[model samples]
Target: MSAYKNLVPRFLRYVKVNTRSDEFSDTIPSSPREVAFLKDLAKELTQIGLSEVNYNPENGYVTALLPSNTTAVVPTIGFIAHVDTADFNAEGVNPQIHENYDGTSVIKLDPAGKYVLDPAEFPNLKNYQGHTLITTDGTTLLGADDKAGVAEIITAMEYLINHPDILHGDIKVGFGPDEEIGTGADHFDVQAFNADFAYTVDGGPLGQLEFETFNAAGAHVVIAGKNVHTSAAKGVMINAIQLGIDFQNALPQDQTPETTSGREGFYHLMRFEGTVEQTTLDYIIRDFKRDGLETRKAIMQQVADDLNHQYQNRIQLTLKDQYYNMVDIIKEHMSVVEIAEAAMQALNITPDETPVRGGTDGSKLSFMGLPTPNLFAGGENMHGRYEYVSTDTMEKATDVILKISELNVQQH
Candidate 1:
C-alpha cells in the first residue's frame, strides 16, 4: 500500500457524505445533513482513540482532544476544517483517479458536457505530472476544498497515536460547518477550544499561508417600480431592469475579479434577476482594509442613490457585513506564523505568504479569540467542477502537518 493510503480513503469516505451547506437555511450547520455527518466523524474519532470527542449539533462544531504523552510545558495547538461542502452540486462524485500523470489533459464526464483538465488552462497541472491526481466527474465538485484538510489532520493524528514515542503537547481538532455559505465561524467557541494559537487547514492551493483576507460584505438591492401595461403606459412606466443596470453602471469598470490582482479590491455583482414590476441585484464588496471595504460599499450606496434619485427612491438597498482580515490579530503572536514557516521549511517547502482574496473561518475565529492562521490544504479550483489536487501535494501537506506538530513541541 502507498504511504498515504489512509488519507486518500478517508477523503473518499467524506465525499460520500452529503453535507452541502445551505445559504438560505437558518440553522447553525445550515443543513440537517451536517448533523448526521458530524456524528459519524465523532464516532470515527472515538474509534481512532481520541479522548473527549464532541459533536454539537445545535452549534455544529466538532472537537476532540489528544493528550500529551510527555508533558514538558508544550503549548497547545489546534487544527480545524469545515465538514460541509459548497452549495454547488455535490451528487454522485465519481472521482476519476489518474495515477502517475504525464502532464497531459485529463478528461472528466459530466451530464452537461465532457470537461478536460487541460494544462493550458490550469498551469499548476504541469507541476504534478508523474504523480496521482483525483478529479471530479465534471458534474460535481470533489469536496477536496476542506475535506482534504479534514482527512489530513485526522490521518496525522492517527500517525502520532500509533507512534507514542513522539512527545507532544495538547492538540485540538476543530471541524466546522457552513464554510462555503460563509457562516463557518458563527458559533466557534474560542475559549473552550483553549489553544495558544491555531491553524485552519482550510487554505486553498498547496504551500499557501495567509494571515490576511478581504473585509467582506453582502449587499442586496431591491428595485420597486410601478406596474403598467406596455401599450398604454408611456410616462408612468418605470422599467426596474433599467434601474438595476443603472446601479451597476455607477461602479468602476476596471475594478473586478477579472482585472484586479494582488491587494487591489473589487465590487462584484454576483447576480441580478428581475423584470419591470421589480428587480433584485446581488453584490459583494471586498477589500484588504476596513476603510476601503467600507468605501466600496459606499460606492454601491451611491449607485443605489443614483438610481433611487431617478426613480423617486424606488430602490431599497440592504448591506450586511460578513468577515474581516485576521492579520491584525495574528500579529500579536507571531510565533505561530514562525512555527508554521519553520515546519514548512523542514519539509523542503517554501511558504507562500499572501493576502487571501476571500475569507476563511480562521479570520473570524481569530477575532473571536483563537488567533487562527490558515495553512494550505493542497486543493485548487475549489467550489467548482474543475477542482483538483495533486497526490504528491496532498502528501506534502500531510508531511507539513506532522512537522508542524513536532516543531510545536521543539519550539515550546
Candidate 2:
C-alpha cells in the first residue's frame, strides 16, 4: 500500500472547522459553518487538480471529477462522504495524535486528566496497536465518522492523479452536508452526478461493507392540556407531561433501542420536552424490513389513539417516513456489492457485511436511481468524545478505493 502521509493531517484540519449540523435548522447545509467549509473544500479540490470542481451553495454539495486516463469503456464510479459532523459539541475541536499506539495503557484526553480513552472500556482500541490514532480532546467528537472518509477520498484521488500509470475510468467525488440529520442527500442531483453506482465512505470500523440499512421514520407526539390553578384544578386541569409519559409507557418496553440489537427493530424516543400545558415527544423508528417499520408505526399510532379515546382526543401523532433500507435496491444491482467485496478481497481485507443500525446518505441515494453502498471509514465510538480513527486503516481504505477503480476497469 502506498503511504498516505497526509491523511491524518487533512482530517485534523477539516475537523477543527466547526461543521456541526443543526437538525432543526431550515437551511440546506443545516449550519452556516458547513458552507464555509464547503467553499474551502471546493478550493482544495481545485488545488489538488481535480477537474470540474464545483460547490453548489444551493444544496451545500461539493462535487468534482477525475476523468479517465484510459479508454476502457468502464462504468463511471463515485465516492461520497458527508462534510458535516453529528449533533455534538464540534466547536474548538483540538485533535490529539497518538503515534504508534501501544494498545495497553489508557489514553488521557483532557489536560485535567479527568477524561480518558481506556482500552478496557473500548476494546477496539487494542486493534490499532502500532498504528497512529487520531482522537478528540474529550470535550467534543473527533468528526472521524465521515471526515476521515472525506480525507481518504481526497487522498485516493490525489494518489490516482499522481500515479498516471494506474489507468482507471471516470470517478465522481461528492461531499455533502447534513448527513447526521438525515437530509444530506435531499438535494443531491443524481442525474448530474451520473455515476452508474457509488459507495459512501461513511461506516464505522474497518472492513464494514454495508448494503442493508434500517428502514427509518420519525414520529412526533404532541399532547395538549388545560392548565388551571392547583387548588381549583380538580377534574379540570390535565397534565400534559404526565400524558406524554403515559404515551411513552404504552409502547412495548422491550422493543426499544436500549434492549435490541442485530436486525431487531426498535422505537427509540430521542427527545422529550414537556410542560404542564403542552408536551412534545420526538421518536425515531428503525427496522430492517419495510413491514417491520410499518408495524412499529402502526403500534405507535394505536397507542396514541387509545390514549386519545380515553382522554377525549387530546393527543396528536405525526409519523413521517425518513429513509428506507437499501437492501431492496441493492439486490437489483448485486454487481455493486460484488465489486466492493472483490476489491476488499484483493487487498486481503476481510469484508464484514453487516446491516447498518442507522440510515446513511447511501440509503437515500440508492432509492434515488443509484445503487450506492456504504464502506467503512475506520472510526470507532463515533458521535462522541471517545471517537478515534486509525491512520493505518484510513490508508487502507484509500487503497481500497483505488483498487476498486482499477478492478472495475480490468473487469470491463
Candidate 3:
C-alpha cells in the first residue's frame, strides 16, 4: 500500500474544481468558484477533526487548528497553501494518472496526440522513475502547482491526528485564494494566526526549500494618440500602436524572462493591447536585490518620460510594488529554516536550498511579521499544460511536515 493513500485522491478531487483566479477582478477571492472551494475545504478540515475551523469570506482564507497532543511548549507552527490555481484554462480538468512510470517513454496527453509530455523537453521527468505520475489532459493545466501542496498538507495533518503516539505542539493550517493573482496576502490576518513561524507548502520539485524570492512589481503603461486618415496623415497624426511598440523597444531587450535565469532580474511584458487611438502595456519587474528592482523600475519610468517628451506628454505609467524578498525577514528567524532543514535531513531527503524565481504567499507574509518559508510539494512545470506531480515526492513532503512538527517539540 502507498504510504500516502489519501493524498492522490484528495489532490484529484481538489483540482477538478475550476478555481482559477482572475487578475482583472477587484473582489476578495477574485472568483466565485474559489470561495466555494474554500468553503468546502473548511468543512473537510472540520470533518478530519481539526479544531477552530473557520473560513473568512471577506479575505477568502480558511484557517484551522490542530490542538497540541504534547505538553512541550514548542513554537506554534503554521502550514499554508493557496486554493486557487493559476490564470489558465482550468475547466474540465481530466487528471491522467500513470502508475509505475518508466521515465523513458513519451506520455500522450490527448486523443489527437497533439500534446505529449516528452522527457526530451522536460528532463525533470526522468527523476520520477518507478513512481506514480499525475498529469493533465492536453486541453488544460493540471492545477498541481498548489493542489498538490494542499493535499500534502491535509494528509500530513490527518496522519498526525490518527497517530496519537506522535507528539507535537499546537499546529495551524491555512488555505487562501488569489495567490496566482499576487493578492493572496493582501488581507491575511497574521496577528490572529498567532504562529511564531510558518511554511508555505507551495514549492516545486522534491526536497526544494526556499527562503528568498523575487522583489516584484507590476507596471502599466498607456499611450494616447490622435488618429487621422492614413492617406492625409504625416506629422498631423500619431499611431498609438506604433508608439507602444517603440516604448517596448526602448527597454533592454536582453533583460527579459527568456534571456535571464538564477538571480538575474528581468522585465516581463505580460499583456499588450493596442489600437490606432490608444495602447496599453502591462509588465512585471523582478530582481533578487532591492536596489536592482528599484533601478529597473526607474529605467521603465525614464523610458516613459523620454517617450512622453517626444510625444507631447501622451504617455501615462503606473508601477506598483507587489512583494519583497522574504530573505531579509527570514534571516532574523533562521531557526524556522533550520527546523525544516533538520526535518528533511531526518528523513534522508537532501534539502535543495534554492532561491525562488517567483514570489509566494510566504514572501508577503514574511514581511507581515510572520517568518514563513516555502517547502516543496513535489510538482514540476507549474502553471501550464505540462504540469505534473510525483506521488512519491508528495509523500516525502508530507513526511517532512509531520517530522518538522515532531522535531520542533524534541529540539525545543
The prediction achieving the highest lDDT against the true structure is 3
Candidate closest to the true structure, highest TM-score: 3
Error of 2 at 150 (Å): 0.4
List TM-score per model, in order.
0.97, 0.98, 0.99
| Candidate 2 runs further than 4 Å off | none
| Residue-level lDDT for 125 in candidate 2 | 82
Ranking by TM-score: 3, 2, 1
Scored by CA lDDT, what does every candidate get?
A: 0.86, 0.92, 0.93
Root-mean-square deviation per candidate: 1.5, 1.1, 0.7
lDDT of 2 by residue, 228-344 (tens): 999999999999999999999999999998899999999999999989899999999999999999999999999999999989999999999999999999999999999999999
lDDT of 3 by residue, 158-247 (tens): 999999899999999999999999998989999888888999999998889999999999999999989999998987899999999999
Clash totals in order = 0, 0, 0
Model 1 lDDT vs. the true structure?
0.86
> Who is ahead in TM-score, 1 or 2?
2
